[model samples]
Target: MLKMELFGESLKQIGCFQFSGVPCSYLAPMINYAINTNSFIMSNNEGDAVAIASGISLANYKKSFGVVLMQNSGLSNALSPLTSLNYTFEIPILGFVSLRGERDDMGNNTDEPQHELLGIITDKLLRTCDIAYDFLDSDFNEAEQQLQVAYDYLAKGKSYFFIVKNNTFEKCALNHDKNIFFEKKINTLQVKDSNSNFLPKRIEVLQHLSYFSKMNEIALFATTGKTGRELYEVEDLDNQLYMVGSMGCVSSLALGVTLQTSKKVIAIDGDSALLMRLGALSTNAYYASLHNKGNFCHILLDNESHDSTGGQFNLSPNVNFAEVAYFCGYEKVFIISSFEELEQALCFFKNRNTGGAILIYVKILKGSKEKLGRPKVTPKQVASRMANFLSKD
Candidate 1:
């Protein structure tokens, strides 16, 4: 068995500090160490972990890095962002995925029934994702060599994985609380005039929000579909990234970027996309509450329909997004239906420097401009420029 310190000290030696992901038994020792050192962000799920880690990688490149941990079963949850976000953007992250079900000498599965299929196919899945991997070594020098190889891959902007077998690390006790909690005075605002029949269109809100991209103090992220396309049409700036895929990961990516840099991150998300990864709301609030240097603003454009894919109705009309965010631990919540209220919310974000997660639920109308064109730049180009902008001191 390998002492956790042998691996942990090597990671620190290579300038990797940020860690995020869900818990896995095989990774508990490392997770406990990360939590004890106050360097880990507990993610809601595997996909969010990948997106969050990608954000950290993008913010500063090789100078800093993030490691994502998960069980092999969680690979299904992580597949989306691993392929769409990380692969498309060419972002690198080191990961530990535990092997729960492995065949013995007689070729018999040794884990529960649920892990059977995934374990049998884990190697193939990683290969399909274009991720290279190596089995973690138990010896000190061998483990250090493996980590250096992983770091070499990361330095070239390529992701690498360690397939952790059972009992890879010696047992380590957790001295810190695993539960995430933050007690702060949260501000709630309901900005519906009740008499005004005016509801902002998607473009109108995007136009107003594009002003933030004009300045470098804020890093703007537009969600997939019409939201990103509309923002691209308004203006593509060095401070903004138009998310092409990974439908619901924009907010989690924003959280990752927020944690890495002092620049405030604003995620302009759609109702459908937000609903796809609802658990991220709590994760954002939880991390923001603890990491006081980072500020994350989540703006949900509730148009009640999927304007990009089709005019199908979504669940947003039935959901109270602002109240849900408040209950989920957002430091501030704003429910607005008119442009005036949106203006007020923007001012609130601009003037306040208090670090925590903030939510703005804006009611918007559907439909886009005639023949709205897609972004001219590729996703890699967009990610590269944003990374450059964030890296500037």
Candidate 2:
């Protein structure tokens, strides 16, 4: 069996870093190794993990593979990116899945009843993804060979999988000495008043972002639903990555991109999406502080409701996202209610020289253009173009 460090070192040899996944007991040892000595993120869900991996791979320019790990039960959650992302863009990922309910000699289920149906279909599901898989077990040479095969597939622009039965890796303990989140000066919001009737619309906000994104060469990652659609309607830029279907992973995707590029990464997020994956905020905060490059922005276009999926309400009215981001280690917090304040905030971001993260809380009204449209390009095209742009800049 491979020790945790050996496994991690082997992965480094293949040019892979930036691990993102949900916590599963079968993955704890390997994850602990990452937590202690490597780049790791505890993502909000399996789908978010996949999107983060996708972001890393898109920014990698065929040089590295990002790893995403999750339990087999979470396969359904990950399917969104597994299909729409890797399959669509030919972006490769070293995905690890925990096979929870593998039956033994007596044929009794090894895990809870909830896993039985999924366990039966796990391999078939991988087959459906057209992804090749190998079991991770007690042989170092054999497992390394399997990884080599996975690398071969990745070189050809495809994802590969590792299935762990139960208890595969040696324990890698988390050392408390490491600072997961670096200390930064506590941030406070400077509020300015605006006319309630003159509050800007969503499309107007997206237009401002689009212009700035192109002007500043900032990589823009928009949340799924109307946010992406509206951004597309405003203008399609090579630097933009539109979230197709992953609802809650906009910031996670932004984090991965921020890690790989010096250009500022801006996530145009929605209230519902943010609420779904609140953990991603802390993940972004921790990594943003560690990878402080003076260029990361998080904009919450909160309409106080799920404006995309009909006027369904979310918790943003009761929850203060600007305050939340401030506590989450964002260096600059801007909670404003008008276009003038937003302009001030963007100017603040443009002029800041050192490490900084900003959250713009604009009290926006709900409405969109009558003829909203999606991005005309494919996800692969979008990713490749962004990769090329990032490489050049």
Best by lDDT: 1
Q: Which ten contiguous residues of candidate 2 have the minimum total lDDT?
A: 190-199
Off by over 4 Å in 2: 112-115, 191-198
lDDT of each: 0.85, 0.81
Query: What TM-score do all the candidates reach, one by one?
Result: 0.96, 0.91
- Candidate RMSDs in Å, in order, are 1.7, 2.4
lDDT by residue (tens digit), candidate 2, 75-110: 888987788767876778888899998887887788
lDDT of 2 at 331: 76
Q: Give the winner by TM-score.
A: 1
